[model samples]
Target: MLLILSNKKQLLLQAKSLLLSASFQQLSRSSELTFTCHKISAIFKQSRPALFNNLYLAMSTQPAKDHTEGHKIPFLLDDHTVTTVRESKILVILRGLPGSGKSTLAKEIEQKYKENSRLFSADEYNIKPAIRSSDGGEYAKLDEDLNTCCERREANLIVLDDTHHDRERLEELFDFANKYHFIVVILEPKTPWRLDCGQLKDRNHWKLSLEELKNLRPALEKEIIPLYFGWFVTKRDEDALRKTSQDFLEQLGNFKPFKKRLQAYGYEDKHKLDLLKYFGKTPNILHCTTKYCDYGKVTGSEEYAQQEAVKKGYSKAYTLHLTALFVTPRTAGARVELTEEQLSLWPLDAEKEVMPKDAFPRGSRAHITLGTATEVQDVQTGIDLLEFIKLQQAGGEREDMGEICGGRIHYYENGMWMLTLPRKIELKTIFSGYYGKAGVSAPQRGGKKVLLPTCQVM
Candidate 1:
């Protein structure tokens, strides 16, 4: 007999002899309870009526467990009923080290079901050179493949084969299961399989070593924790935003305040501002941060992550309204106005971060960081937003910097500027739970090149 506690669900694995020999008297006397009495009673009632009668007799001789502390037995669940329950459409999410038999188990399950199941493997897509060319583009392709499978699922089981070390990534599949009303069954091996095995090594497959995997787990989890969630700009809108940002940066150079500040810093090149280098590279993950959890590192983050409403809304798309663009010496970002529906997803205490309690409105710091200053981390963008909001609240006289690129520039103190767009840009975006490593190179296959545009907008 064996007992396992996982995700609050208990599993009882037993031999037939143990099941047959188990009596009410023996069950009542045993200190180790594998299952609640009601569960045992229900199972016995269906499988062995005689045993259940004896169990009822034994229950009459002793006090029953308090109802509040025990599960209510709904019905006598027979083996057939149990089998029927298990036969429902299931999403089996396989998670483990690269060589730890995930794909092997997936294949076995697929074969067992044959025509009643299908397996979706990320590795299958990874091996194709044409699909593996763009950085961060594989996620979109994987989503497309998974969505396609979910839409046309005529099977009892769908096996998702991937190295789902990140919880947010796993949540993406979970969201699909929740939408399609499929039960999620997560399978993870206890021990990691070696990635450097002879056969695996010979295949030239991408994998992480045991040590590297161990080191990466925390970082991946931290990133996956939705430190901040926001709507990613659509492909069409992203192009316009990029152009608008570049033109704004060039226009900033013409301003007297900016010129004086640059000259003060001993910069004499007036012909060309080279603002692109000053603002640094554009962010790989583009979205406004509604809340920053700091990888569950901040207080109350754990509670926030576990909120039922938060989980229910995970990965749902939203339309964010861009109200204005803000700039400081340290950052360039967009101010977003959250709607009523969006506000429901935003935590009440999100704005309490790095500020005096109740100082700013709930969603005042909602902004997308276009670029960050050299040596500044992305999180600093939120701080810059808070600073801008605070400055506005202090009621400074706005220096009308006039119209530039169809937007009005109003200068705030301390080299801070707000360019309120003539019209709010309504952007269509999907909620990506986690952003992977900032700029990872796409995997190469077979020494072949995939032709891509040099000036791609998205």
Candidate 2:
């Protein structure tokens, strides 16, 4: 009986050990699955954020809710939605250094857009990947291919995969986009090690050295070249200015001398001439333009953007005192009296370029264009300002048209009028650059869309 009891105890111990082993294996398997899930989640989060968000909501303990309403996912839009909802043409320009995962991102974008997307890669054209291209032959061919793609309108979305470090190259792409009426979206890789030269050296397909990678870093590190640089007026100030400018226009319309001048300039029905429509609202941020970079296509633009003064002043706020309101047949603007600090960011040759013969001080041509005449471009505003300065310097007869809007009005020949204010109009503004967009629209303010005129400097 004692032997049987001992055997039973041993059997019980063996059963308990087997049960523990089974439990341990099960736990190990669960942990492995959890880790894999996490890895997959991370990848999806990066590649397909919208889809991942939906999946996460579905898998949550709470009830799944559709945050997107009825609109389909960007990648999975139905035929009806594609035809009606989306922009007809889009050019996605992937910009980054080699090994920065630009190509990877391009592939993902192409995959997301599916059959509607077509990718044009410089590598496919046999152009070596570098900050600067040694040969123009392959690049020219690549441009031609892209041009053809744009001409054909073959795809809803066209992806260009390349370093795109050169501003000139980017300008060419912008030109293609403009010609094709395609919305241009520049995308840089979100990889943490994108700018890490050492990592890039190892990861790059070309096996470029650390030195080569470093050489490519400077161009990417520099500030993005803008279509133009200037002081952006605050919304509040802009509204006030708009009202003041409208009032001034009304005052000018009623003034007989101004009417006579308009009549002399072929505006036969001077009384009927709508000055507001004659000088349409410019669709741009109301600011005094400092330099028109033209997206680095202009000579010395890149250098001007890279200046120490420009770098320091960028996005910084400063006060501009508007001393006068001036109007020409081409443009209407308020002259900005730049402080010494503001003058530091002003291009030395800005005024000289427009009036090379005169030795006007820096910032002399600084003016915030309120409006431009029909068919006249914004650049004409600065030229008009210079012309006014030249007339002022030449001691041209000033017909004192008396005070309008609490300012002394002086007519300076050939439909050029100036209003010198009793007190300077002070404006708060931030120094910034304007990159071209699909439309001339400002951020929504007070639940209403604020539209700005397109900066048609180019």
Candidate 3:
């Protein structure tokens, strides 16, 4: 990565340092560090001639043995690639509560497009004489099977029918579609939902009455909760990140450009930036987001919630490596380095929401929010990270005005910049999931739960 520098001398120095650090990391992981260095050299050669000069000189001095193995690194997926994939296949996601007629609509849609469409549902994955009880494991398996159907179904259109009432669950489906290059169309049943399944002749096809669907929360089920899965930061690491961010903000307050901007904003005392007061404390829930599902509002979220991989990996603990600490006037945060295993749960287009598909690769903004400006949402932290990285990618130069006790500070345009830490910080974190407020209720296990007429899904 070509981090912006204030001057030529610092640029060369930081470039050398960055390569050495990457080399060490690569060496530790495998014998691929040398090739990675060469790739960096190539990137710099094309985008940053000055820095490449320094890197080339340094690489010339290294032993030839370092270049023994070479591997071609793939480029990021561009719009053309995604567009072509989407053109070839499409995915239709059906959403609604049971008895909302989701199945009937899915069947009709599939039949109408029979020549090009195929339908998949959780009911197909259920065992013979399947029980009606809410079970996480069973749902997990069904999610996996549904995903498999998406992957292997030989058709231009695939329809997934289920009670996809939660958003977080739907995000998973989008993730799958991204991987497979399929376009997603969500269809919610329009018919009014009735309480009963109307006494199906099949004994195994049991349905809950309106009363049973209004009291208890369903465990491990996608319909009841809006779950967000991510990597949580440890207490110690979070403290260190917060301290670094605070110091960076204080230095930012001292910058002449920043001071002038503050004056323009009506701040006479611009020498000391009240970073703590200006930017509120970091959120209590510190995490590197893997996915954000807005209660199944996002396309394909319901299928994602039931995904088997997510279920099995839920709540597992892993070590997170902090690569850099960055601060902008709007936010302060840390960029996390995700391991291969961790990447499996990461949403393919997480960064694309803020930056264009060609601008940054997937997961480029994976970060922990340390703090945010007044009235800013916590999610802005990742946006700030993308802006910082984008500037570096463009070989945009900033002023290396000073340094902190823990890192070096550089000033970019618009009161945005980053503090590059001298050392990578590693913290132990758990792979936890989140469920927002229960928008709907389920039947109590042993009691007769009260029914609400409005309790329906779509």
Candidate 4:
């Protein structure tokens, strides 16, 4: 076994870490062939159970070999090469009042799926401790995991486990599967996740006051919610609904509706509106829809999203988040007067809107730069451009660049101050937005080839 582990570095390292600290009792529980803490802890002085990656660690807890058919399944992913397995995407939707056992159901689903090698759970992949609900990045991380699994050349199957209560969030996953030519299995509960007032209070873990009870979910059986950002259009007027629907459909087509609203960033409507109202003069402002609820229905937060995810799919997927950008100057104010010697990158072209007409826009935010500058820089430069934002905010309730934040004062290779805000307003990738060389999907080689890189079962 040691000889085999040395040949696979990642697995060996992971195995080594697990083997050293695991309890002897726990070691006996693991299969000899699979990743196990006992196998990994063999080299370590003490078992550092918390140090192991949860997905690998929890699964590794059963440190033993699969001895069947007079054959043993290898201990590592590298060791157990096999025939293809079936994969499909799942969206488990739980709808109910609070204390409907939605979270418990989700866990059961997660345990069931992990038995398969192809399964990946969002909780296992997205959060570090796995069960904790307070982590800040569960949503974005889950999206990343789903994205990675969809793009994997080696993965034959993948499931997006999550709750999808309504069309808004569920549709995104459905659309993603459709784009990749994969099946979407939507699991609706036999009943939504809810219980009668009397029954809910009977549960041992149930906790809620009479005042707080109103906010809890309603009486439904399958307490699950879909795991993506979403919305719903509601109105009493028939003509208004039709008009609103048409307008919304058009907005969706342009990807404008998803911008900055509940679908884009989960934020309060008033704050979003404050941002939206400013765009009247700046038409490039994106039309983002604030998260829509049923007049007063309280929507779930990030934790509910992951629990629902656990129930939604056949297997769970892994997640990662990446944010990087290319710098470009804003073509305004002080930047207009700067010389090429003082500034770098293309001067912001005045003719274009702050954002392209077709692209979805985000609320204009204020950012401040507090570094010593020897000269008044060109607005055409990124710093000058961002400074203009600071100037605009100075006029409103905003005084010091929206909120105080920090980053390095980077100088271009040619010595120009670059002041910019964090990553915001990136457009959602649309199927129609595919642009590559010669109409190819996504040009891998670069010089303008259209290349749409998706997937297929090999």
In order of listing, the candidates' clash counts read 1, 6, 16, 74
Evaluated at residue 110, the lDDT of candidate 4 is 46
lDDT of 2 at 199: 74
lDDT of 4: 0.29
Model 2 has how many clashing residue pairs? 6
Which of the numbered candidates is closest to the native, going by highest TM-score? 2
Q: Model 2, which residues run further than 4 Å from truth?
A: 1-194, 199-223, 437-458
Residue-wise lDDT of candidate 2 within 1-458, one digit each (tens)?
Answer: 67645644554444334333443224234554445446546555776688557645533411111112211223223443233213335566777778777776676667766766889988788667675554555588778777777677677678899887776677667666655545445556646567999878876777889998788788887657777888766545666677777677767877877887775446764556666666765644577889887767788899998798886565455668999888888878998998998899899999877778788878888999888765677788888888888888888788898888877899988889998887888776656666654233221112222344422111
Model 4, 1-458: lDDT tens digits are: 67644634565555556456564344445575354444554433244444445535555433222111111111112111111112222233333333444344444444444554244444455332112243334556666666776677334234443323333344455455445544223332222213354644443133554444443333223323222222111111112222322232222223322222332223432232221111111101111111111222334332333433223311222111112111222211111121232112111222223334322112221111111112322212333343434434454232121211122223232112232324321221100111112211211111221222222101
287-310 per-residue lDDT for model 3 (tens digits): 777777655666656666567665
lDDT of each: 0.57, 0.68, 0.56, 0.29
Among the numbered candidates, top lDDT falls to 2
C-alpha RMSD by candidate, in order: 15.4, 14.9, 27.3, 24.5
Residue runs of model 3 more than 4 Å from their true location after superposition: 1-227, 247-269, 438-458
**Candidate 4 ranges beyond 4 A from true positions:** 1-138, 153-163, 188-193, 197-458
* Cα-based lDDT at residue 261, candidate 2: 77
Candidates by lDDT, descending order: 2, 1, 3, 4
Better of 1 and 4 by lDDT: 1
| CA shift of 206, model 2, Å | 21
lDDT of 1 at 182: 55
Full candidate order by TM-score, most accurate first? 2, 1, 3, 4
Candidate 1 lDDT at 125 equals 74
Better model by TM-score, 3 or 4?
A: 3
Per-residue error for 278 in candidate 3, Å, reads: 1.1
- Name the lDDT value of residue 363 in candidate 2: 86
